[model samples]
Target: MLNYKQKKNQPLKGNRFLISVTVLGSSGPIRFVVNEEDLVGAVIQTVLKSYAREGRFPALGSNLNDFLLYCPISETEALSPWDNIGSVGVRNFMLCRKPQTETAIDVEKSPSVSRKATGSWKTWFNNALTLKISSH
Candidate 1:
């Protein structure tokens, strides 16, 4: 059991952690001192503020809610806005802008073929070769 004074001073003793925020295609990452209990949303807001202070444009826009924090190591997992930074067990992550519907359509219209379709074609060719060899 802790007393009131101890509890009040708990957060003052090494409660903050240093983390890096990198915008994709940007010059470099910026370091920030953030409270361990701060949520992902708060960290993002801090990042936006820092960018603004540095005169970086397109840092945030009307669709600010679409941005997400993604851990490169665990590509499939994304940090939730409500989750605390310390709780996630990661000190670094990339701030990625979620692709809008219109952007995705533009990507599809490009000349490059989809990887999934190419992969299926490769599999079909391999299976056909295997069948031919087996028949012979």
Candidate 2:
């Protein structure tokens, strides 16, 4: 019979693998062991917990849905929350927050107002340049 110590780091028997997740805005990556079948969402939750436990800076809140996990190779796309972490086949990953949509603001000024502002600046600049050139 194999002991727990002997089975450490053996994926065949333990199904656990070590992976490093770099939190966005963090100074360094946090390493942890996770099961191969773990979902991406679960991995992200674990990472957030570990990040908080370590007392790292830029304290991200406990909202798991707000975070995203991305593979270094495919940074343009974030891993699906339903996908298994092991499916990415990479030990290193990046965690970042989902971008928040900008709030719409009601503007009282019209387009003509902005155009007049720009035209007035140009007129002032041209007049200054003409005066300087004529004086010299």
Candidate 3:
């Protein structure tokens, strides 16, 4: 009974594990422990806090919604904010700012100049390729 009581008094930390999150454009990754059941969005917030606390460089602002988290293996798709970190089953993650959306005016301008841009691009590419092939 005494052993059981002593065990009960100890903190339960089974669901927690250390994870390393690499902030894009930062010099190094941030290592911290987190609960497996914690949501991805929550994890990002925690990572940001830790980064700022440590005074890491490139001063990322404090906007949780401005960032996205990804597993290195599945980089094409960011992990959903609603998903649990444990669901990914990976200890390493990458955090990057959400890409800024292009404005409608930019899209409209592209179509008018696309033909000229394509011609220049093709010419530049062909010349570069030719030089490389000729050197071999």
Which candidate should be chosen as best, given lDDT against the real structure? 3
Better-scoring candidate (lDDT), 1 or 3: 3
TM-score of each: 0.60, 0.66, 0.68
Tens digits of per-residue lDDT, candidate 2, 37-110, equal 77888888888889999999999987888887888787478899888888888999988877755333413444
Task: Kindly give the number of clashing pairs for every candidate.
Answer: 0, 0, 0
Clashes of 3: 0
Candidate 3 backbone collisions, by pair: none
lDDT of 3: 0.77
Q: Judged by TM-score, which candidate is best? A: 3
**Which parts of model 2 have CA positions greater than 4 angstroms off?**
1-14, 105-136
Q: Look at candidate 2 and give me any clashing residue pairs.
A: none
Off by over 4 Å in 3: 1-14, 106-136
Question: Residue 40 of model 2: what lDDT?
Answer: 89
Deviation in angstroms for 99 in model 1?
Answer: 1.4
Per-model C-alpha lDDT, please?
0.65, 0.75, 0.77
Q: Which ten-residue region of model 3 has the weakest summed lDDT?
A: 1-10
